[model samples]
Target: MRYSKFLLPTSKEAPSDADSTSMKYMYRAGMIRKVSAGLFYYLPYFNMILRKVNFRIRRGMEKLNSNEMKFPILVSQEILESSNRWNAFNKEMFKLKDRNDNGYAISPTNEEYATLVSNLFVKSYNDLPFSIYQIQQKHRDEIRPRNGVVRAREFTMKDAYSFHADEKDLHDYYKLMGEEYTKIFADLGIKTFPVLADSGAMGGNMCHEYMAISPEGEAEIGFCDACGYAANLEKVECKDIYSIDGTYKNKYDKIETPDAKTIAELMNMLQMEAKQFVKSMVYNADGNLVMVLVRGDRNVNEVKLANFLKATNLELATEKEIKSIGSVMGFVGPIGDLQNVRIIGDFEIKGMKNFVVGANEKNMHLRDVDACDIKCEWADMRFADENDVCPKCGAPLHVSQGNELGHIFALGKRYTEVMDSVFVGNDGKNHVPFMGCYGIGLERTVASIIDQHHDEKGLVLPMSVAPFKVDIIIVDTKKENQVKTAEELYNALEDAGVPVLLDDRSERAGVKFNDFELIGVPIRVTCGRSIENGKLEIVRRDNGETVEVEIANAKDFIINMIKNY
Candidate 1:
């Protein structure tokens, strides 16, 4: 690629709306242009990066006997209906009506379509195990797009689905797919950690996500420092850290606590520790009023709460709703028979003896209250914080944030059973095949690579994914000897099977250097006044390491350097 002929629109400033390192660099490097919120137009340079990453994804999928296949961006309503995803996805889906009065959805995923496709081919027991993959566009109606392509509504993804004759076969193939995903990220020069994830609407009991560890990521993961037990924070669980002592005993009593609406205020008024209080929170769980009790210092994990209650939606109850249940604002308790309101207690709350709680009266509280006197269901409902013990090992858990690069789900029979996707068994009877799904977002992966491998100068793209391996900069294109030498080296490098970029533009040396660094071409060979020394300089983009090589051997030195990168 020649700089004079290519669409290399490098800039000094990135978009003002860019909030992350990759978002700023991609916009400044002219890799992608935003067309709307969560929508972008990929330019030539971005296309190059996309192709390289997609190639690695394809290579990894092929290792599992997966064949490449393409599905339509628009899936039919009937297909989604068969799998019940059309109703399950609900508002999250990009649904529209066609001119024929038929509804369709811009597929968020292809579980329905993949199951239908399998129904066509898997008619006999011989075709019991197989996998198919596609690199195509996926759409979702994102309410608020953030972090550029990381949360975009429309994007490209490599999605693969596998089918097996039984659950055992699915589990084996699932393990193999996990290994393949790890290798795929490694091949792209990106470090990732696979952690247990929740398959929310995908309707699977087992799923894991390959996370690119970073503070700028959108997801949080909790892992053990002593062992390899890691899980998404939304699904993570920890052992109870609070336990009851042997000696103390208490009887419930009411106390007057005036003008103390919050825990902090109540703590100061009564001069009691936060751990001595049992706080109650009211929520509208799918329109059913419920009160959740926990230790004062602990907070609730609403995701866990909703999952436990099997509720589609959960939120803090409004003041009007709270009063309608005969509970005063900021003074709700679990012991009252005021209404049919449900009460849920955290597991730690069960062991708490004679703790403080609201008296369900204006400016009042109850102290020395035992949890046995209250009627409620108990479960693990608090978020795991620092110093919390790990569920796998008894070690203290460590927490970190990461971006989800790839996710694989062990979808046992969600789609296969609903869509009637099955095969004839060897016993001459039909049996539903188990299913698995794996996905990697192309743009999100590219952005994560930049986020992981960039510096102040610009993106230090990996050799495998760089737009060009060697950037041959003809510093001072007016000099005949320098231009001629650069052209020769460019040709030599290209002929040696290197992706070379010839910067024969009439730009200044500083401008050329900055542009190439911003675009992050792997190796840069500058031919200028240095050519008078019978040598050219090879500068590494990642580390700024410069090596002087003879003009006759410049091509070989760069090729070797790139091979080592």
Candidate 2:
């Protein structure tokens, strides 16, 4: 590739809307252009890198005995409905109507389509235990798609699904896929931690997510440095509540709290730790007013709460709804004039000796209330934070943010039973096949790579995914000797099976070098006046190290440097 013929738009000014390092560098390097809030256009330069990444992934997948296949981007709604994902997926799924008023959707995922394909072709157990993967576009209506490609409504994904006749086969394939994922990330030069994760709508028991640690990440993971136990915060478990030593005698009473609404206000007014106060909230779960109680210091993990209630729909009750229920916004509690609402309390609250709770009346609260007197169902309904002790090892949990690049789910019989994907055994008995899904967000992975490998200058692409392996720069393009020598060296590098970019533009040496660094071409060959003296300079983009080499040996030197990178 020649800079004179290519669109290498490099800018020193960062976009005002760029919030992350990857977004800023990608924009400055002209690798991607934002079309909408969560939509982007990948330029040719970035597309080249994407192609190389896809090649690596496909090569590894082939070695794992996985077949590459492409599925339709637009799928009929009937298939999704049959799999019970149409409603389960809800608004996050992009749906549309075709000319015949038939419902369709831009595939958010191809689990249903893959299952349908398997049902059409696969019959007996002999056809089982095969995996197919595809690199294709996926659409999800993210409520808040911020941080550029890290969370996007439209993006590329590498999704693979494996079918097996039995649980043993599924487990074996899952382990193999895990190993392959480790290798994939290793090949991309990223060290990732596979943490247990909640499958969410994917409907699986055992799931793991490949997380790349980054402060800009949205997902919160709870990690115990002492025990090395890590899990997504939504799934993190805490120890059982400490037993209370004594019983309380104070009767439930309402007192004026006076304009104290938030937990902080209540804590400040009462001058007590949040652990000593009860946080009561009203939730509308499937049109039922459910009173949820947690320690004031702890936040609610809505996923855990929803799963506990076994409710399909749950949301915080609106202020208006709360007012209609005969309770003020700030002073709501479980005890009040009798109502049909279900009251649920956190397990920790049950062990609390004497605590303060909302009075369910305006500007009032009940202090030193006994849990034995309070009547409610105890549940693990709150999020575990840094202060919480790990249920497994008793180590304090440390919270860190991470980006989910890949997720593997051990989906056992959920979809297969619903879709009637069955197999016959040697004993002639019909059995549902076990299923597993593994997914990698292709664009997010690229964004995460940039997030991890960039500096103030620009993107510092890992050598494995760089668009070009080497960039050849003529320090003085106006000098015919330098230009000729650079061109010859570039050709030689290309002949040596290295992807080389020739900076033949009329730009100054500083501009060319800056562009090369911004784009993160791993190796650079500088042909200047020194080249006329039978010497050339090789610069590494990652570290600003320049090595002088004889002009005759420049090709081998560049190739060797790239090999090491």
Candidate 3:
């Protein structure tokens, strides 16, 4: 491809809205244009990179014997309702009605459709352990789109679903899919690690997210180096490390603590430590009011709370909801006679003998409240942090931010059973096929590769995914020798099956150099005054390694480098 002919719109300044390195560089490199929030107009360069990544993914799927097919972008409401996800995904789904008043959604995922497809074809157990995949667009109405394509509302995804006869077979295939996902990311030159994750909304028995560590990431990861135990922060197991050793005292007294609504205020007023006070929090768990208690310094892990209560939606109760349950917004307590509300306490607070709690009234609190005085069920609901130790090896846990690249779930019968998708077993009995779901976000993965490989200059795109392997820049396009040498080398490299980009534009040498660097071609062969010495300079974009090669050998040199790349 010649730069003069192609739409390589390189720019000097990044977009003002670009927040991360990947977003900024991708915009300046002319790879993508922002159409709106969470939406983009992918340019030819971005499309080429996407194709390379998709090819790697397709190769992995082929290795797994997964058939590739296409499904409609719009999924009917009836099918979603059959799987009971119509209401569950309502917040994120882009819903619309057809002319006939029939509602549908721009499918966020195709679990229902995949199960229905399996039901249509799999008549017996012989078709039990097969997988099918599609590289198609997926849509979700993101509440806040950030970091460009990392959290886009509409983007491409490779979603694969596997069906098996039983739970064991499903688990086996799920493991294989996880391995394949690891290889696919590896092939794309993106480093990722799998961690246990919560199966939110998907309703799976188990799941793991492949995470790439980045500060701009949204997902929090808690990992241990000693035991090699890693999990999504929302799913980390907190051990019961709180136990009081002193003698118990039944001292529960109400006190007038004026204007101490928060734990910090209460601590300042009473001159007490954060661990000495218990916080009473009210949450709306799937429309049911529940009171949760934890130490003042601890934060509730909503994922664990939702999993414990088997609730689809869990959020903090509003002031009106709290008042409806006869609990004050800032003075909720486990000791109150809250009607129709379940009281749950964190396991760490079970051994507490004397602690401060809310008085269940405005500007008031209870001092020296004992554990026996509070009526609640105890469970582990506190978020794990740096102070926490690993549940497996007792080593100090490390916390970091990570972006989710791929996710594989052991879905079991969540969709098949609900959708009435079944197959005939060897015994001639109808059995619900167990399912496993695997997904890779094509754009997010591309951004992650940028995040992991870039430097101060620009993207250090890997050879496998770079838009062009070599960028042949003619420093002096007006000079006959420079232009002639560059054109010859570009044609030869192209003939040798190397993706080459020739900068034949009438731009300054510095401008040409900057553009190619920003574009991040693997190899850059400069045709300049050096051609007068029967030599051209070859520059590597990755490490900026420059070497002078004879014009006679430039084509073979670049081809060998790409062959080994």
lDDT of 2: 0.83
- lDDT tens per residue, model 1, 426-501: 9999899999999999998999899888888888999989869988999898999998998888888788888898
**lDDT pick, better of 1 and 3:** 3
lDDT of 3 by residue, 1-565 (tens): 9999998788889978998888998999999999999999999999999999999999999999899999999999898889888889748999999999999999999998899899898888998797899999999999999999999999999999999999999998888889888888888898899999998999888999999999888899999999888999999999877654554455678899888899999889999999999998899988899998999999888889988999988889999998888878888888766787898899888777678998778888888887777767888988999988998899999999999999999999999888888788999898989999999999999999998988777888998898789999888878998888888888888898888899999988999898888888888889999889999899888877889998998888888878776
Between candidates 2 and 3, which one is better according to lDDT?
A: 3
Clashes of each: 0, 0, 0
Which model, 1 or 2, shows the larger TM-score? 2
Candidate 3: segments with Cα more than 4 A from true spot: 243-250, 271-273, 351-354
Q: Report the CA-based lDDT of candidate 1 relative to the real structure.
A: 0.87
- lDDT of candidates 1 onward, in order: 0.87, 0.83, 0.89
Instruction: Report the Cα lDDT for residue 188, model 2.
Output: 86
Residue clash pairs of candidate 3 = none
lDDT of 3 at 465: 95
